[model samples]
Target: MGKYIVIQGQNIYDVALHIYGAVEGVTDLLVNNESVSFDTDLKAGDELIYSDDYQINKEVTAYYKMHGITPASGEQHVYPKVFSLPKTVEIYTSAKEVGVEFSVSGNGKIELDWGDNSEVQTITLSDKITVFSHLFDSTIGNKRHVSMYMQGHINQLDISGLRPIELYILKSIPIERFVLNNATLSIDSLPMLETAFGVSLDGLKTNDLTPLLELKNLMSLSLTQTIYRQPTIDAYLIGLVRQHDNRRNCKVVMTARPSGEYREPTRDSNSHYRITSGMEAVWVLTHEPAWNEGGIWEFIINETTYKYEQNH
Candidate 1:
């Protein structure tokens, strides 16, 4: 007989293999730890018992009797075990879509309160990862307050979903870290990034950079893997500096290393002059000269400053 403490990703078979050098001992281990079933999701710090006696523990025998689970006298039963609801759930909403993802440890249904005076929705889920998505109705207003409910026991009961922009306007929450890699952001959605101190739009497929100028509080911005041409990049930088000229003092930081295909600079020489004066400090990430590198650029205009880093 022996006791083992479960670690992350360690299952009953793993414990059996570690203790008895064979997975065939898993049934024996379960019989000793009758409180735990074969389908139980083990967590770290859980205690497990293993032995060669093959005697079913009193707790397990009681559980089987209470649940009316039975098998032939000589056979071992492996059925779905009752589980508690997940401790965490995530909800994401965009302009047109709403998505919810969560884990279910057992068979159950989830109830949702959209908080729009609409009928509550219930969804059945099995033991697995569950994802629910729906098209958002514009009539529901730009903001949505959502609540989730489940039948089983859990640590948290009040979960709400709010739009990124709503969090800023209603709660005065300034977004410090934002990532939109490979996402198509609409002009109307740009306001969500307005108060963000740091933002990444890598692999974005937008043709308009003008909307980004509205991010007056932006400290660091990454446009890596974006589809902006040299002219568009120049225009965006110029516009950003002009908008910030008298509002705040800012600095630009860049690294010397270029990634991606090299491209020619924009044709406007006046734009280059603005880059030199308005740009407090420019760092080039490419092997090319700081002034010629097409990857990253920094500029400061009067009281406004911003740093940009890009990869081909």
Candidate 2:
């Protein structure tokens, strides 16, 4: 059988890269083929053919053929031991220069390109900060950056291949899926990334999301409110516990509001914990305070007083 080389879905540079490892390696051979250049990219179905002589052949072949270069008939052709660096990036631009794109859901896609051998990256911008810069072209003496930012609503950031260098969230928004490969996230622009996908506060700093619990979409919340004035604090805690006990699934952690008396909820075998009176602190921690079949309920008046209450 005659030995033939075939490369499918690659441009001249890519074929050359497969043959000699770099575009520079086959510059002399491919310079005669003016249709292809070093930077000229190829699609998924391009092909290059070589005859049994290991020389370039001008013939179109099937779509699903062998990729890269192959050996010639009698010559012991050795493929490149190494290859050029593959570009590491996938980017998307915004249509509305300052508006939302993929607000909540959908199979929508933006733009993607791995210009050269660059590091992976991910970036996010809030409404206030609405500009993303990138260096897509390297040969232009100076790096180039494209502008991508919207005004209202959360933009679905789509940079898959590049490692994350920086991420910025301008305003508070329910993050659907903000992935950063390996970079520090900048959230200084007014409560950025309040919740992940508008459901829970996962992958976010606790303090940054406290104020957003009031959002209607946030379900099953665990709120911890501290109270001072020991005597009054117990009442407050009890009231909150009673309110939250029957809710679906919620919790609250509390510490003294004004640094009076600091008391944490304690469990007692006999169901009686100590409480204190006025000018002290008390804790009334409750967890979904619905009616239970049988359980011990301890009530602390302040930090000295204690009450043994049974759950009905």
Candidate 3:
């Protein structure tokens, strides 16, 4: 069949005129290149077939071959398209749950490999926002390698899950928050908690402040409404606040109340004595000014010059 390579600003009609000297040849052109839309503008590298009896000119065929253009077989390969995932996917290995929210831009199927040597999970994607969850067994290692395949390309991520204390020698999981208010926190789990940006020990029952002291990156510690009422626990937690404040050079806000319906500890003279004694008796307490309105107080350590600020 005769073939013509469509160049810039050229259409089927133009190709017909150039090849057969008549616009009526466009019908033959369309019949041969049925894959092309009649109204669509021809791309610069489009190959238009004209007649089955007429052979493509040797020069034009060589030109197409040199440019790596192959004759279209009338079948087009369409791949699935995907949009960028909205947020970082966080999967809690301890809970064995995947929490992800994203949108698919094109038609395709998504395959998720949870890196546990298990069967791959697949889901169909419609052109809309999708929020889905997947539950699987906890991954074995410190770092979980999950692969997502869409179309023919693959996107992978090293999903960090809850790591055991034995894996502490390895890289720490990039966890931003650790919330175990009423749950029993083992000393071994302290290493995993070391990298948390925020740790909430609101209702912690353990008196072992040693584990919490290791969390040097803590930004906020909530002790306001918890079951911690022991004098020693209070003292140790105050010490933890001091150590965290001095080491991180970040103010640690400890929320407490003098009296409330909650059965938690009341910040009394005993708590004050523990705080002072824990700070080598060099700590000074200062209450916020009356204009502050809120009954806020500050405990300053003279040695490290760390302030344990408290807000009512």
Q: How well does each candidate superpose onto the true structure, as a TM-score? A: 0.32, 0.25, 0.32
Overall lDDT per candidate, in order of appearance? 0.44, 0.32, 0.43
lDDT by residue (tens digit), candidate 3, 1-312: 766777766656456545553335567777787787656567878888778454333443344446554332222211122333222222223323343222232354656555342355566755443444444432221234444444421121111222211112223434445444444333344554465655555544544555666766655555434444445444654555355333342333433322212122234666733333333311322321231233222332222233324552
Best to worst by lDDT, what's the order?
1, 3, 2
| Highest lDDT model number | 1
Off by over 4 Å in 1: 1-173, 246-312
Output the TM-score of candidate 3: 0.32
* Model 1 collision count: 12
**Least lDDT summed over 10 consecutive residues: which range in candidate 2?**
55-64
The deviation in Å at residue 73 for candidate 3 is 46
> Model 1, residue 48: displacement in angstroms?
58
Give the worst 10-residue stretch by lDDT in candidate 3. 152-161
State residue 65's C-alpha deviation in candidate 1, in Å: 49
190 in model 1: Cα distance from truth in Å? 2.2
Better of 1 and 2 by lDDT: 1
